[model samples]
Target: MKKQPIHKIHIFGSVGSGKTTMAKNLSKVTGIPCYEIDNAVWIRNPSVDIRRTDQEIERNLQSIVQTNSWIIEGVHTKDWVNQSWQHADIIVFLNTSYFTRTLRIIKRFIKQKLGFEKANYQPTFRLFLNMFKWNKQFEKVDKVRFLQMTEMYEEKLIIINNRQDLNNWINNL
Candidate 1:
């Protein structure tokens, strides 16, 4: 018997938890297209980012999942994302450390501010502060909620707490 190739993947985690990095890496190795959930939620522009209508978001998500292969990454655990999981072959929960995420937030902000990194929205001081708040909220609230919601999908869920674990999982794939 042989293992089947993964076609659809969903990666969820707090801000700066390396969800995007993991998704991009997996997509690179597997030749799957990677998408950011934030992109589905927001209409990106040079001046400002506008929120997409709920229907629009749903339609967009549906279009992506209807494809043969994709890697979707985000921290969003709302009802809108439920359908993605339903179609996913695997769901990855990145349980990165608070300290590490905090550090990455700062580094990412600096890079984005200095034009070394591209961002969908402007990296303002307020947004930088909000990232920390969001990180805390994810740890305190969303993390528990996500765990509860994902209980039904335990068979396909993979929780990676550190780089070694992530590396090992990717290697096995």
Candidate 2:
């Protein structure tokens, strides 16, 4: 069966789970604008991230959601982002394995450090180390929260466990 066209898409996952990649690809294929939550959360600083105020972040996100069509991607699943999920026609959760996410995080750090990849934050060793910690924290806390929250939007939620699942979903789209 043909898939319905998606207008508002929200992609959420743990760090290094390829949310940004998938959002970009969906934007390209669907002709929808993509909004990265990092842009709303952090000020552009070459050396370190200076986070925007909570009000500022919410304002930015609200602006994006006010648009007719958009794809929002981020690892953030906090209360502040509940509106985005509520507005979404589809919500994607990239539930990639811990091993895969760890490797991707390492590879991404190297690429960003070498200037081969564009990143939201500086490719500092400190940031790289923190990714591992963040990953673990997400697994222990955020994962359960995501699962629970998704239950409320089960009809719109799509969980991609691996690259094959992601590819198939995109292909169907």
Candidate 3:
């Protein structure tokens, strides 16, 4: 079967769910520019991290969506990201197991701490601990919220629960 052309893509999931990795892969396959919402949300400072103003974030997001085609990935599912969801031709939601996500988080932190991986923020012990808390919060609270929000875009939403499911979806694409 012929693969459908994707113009705009949005990937959302909990930390360590591989949203960025999937977005990068999709960008490579589709030749669409990929934008990380974290970049828009946080202003990278070498000494300390500062957050962008709401207006700034909105403007940044607007600019990305205005492009001809792009992939946007982030764990954010709040009102700030509603526009991206509305503009997306497809929304990929990674729902891997909590165990898998936890392991990934540990591995990712190690990679970032060792400077083997590029991260939007400095990987510190606080951030490392927060990942676990965020993962739990995501499973307990955000999962239901994300499901409810994505239901309106059911036709465009694709949920992948495991590596095999992800590979199948990408291969079939």
Best by TM-score: 1
Better of 1 and 3 by TM-score: 1
**Candidate 1 at 148: error in angstroms?**
1.1
lDDT of 3 at 122: 82
Return the clash pairs for model 2, or none.
Answer: none
- Each candidate: RMSD: 1.0, 1.5, 1.5
**Model 2 reaches what TM-score against the true structure?**
0.94
In order of appearance, the predictions have TM-scores of 0.97, 0.94, 0.94
lDDT of 2 by residue, 1-173 (tens): 77776899999999999889888887887799999998999889776679888889989999999888999998886677888998899999999889999999999998988889987676888888999999999999999998887788999999999878987987777
Off by over 4 Å in 3: 1-4
Q: Name the regions of candidate 1 deviating beyond 4 angstroms.
A: none
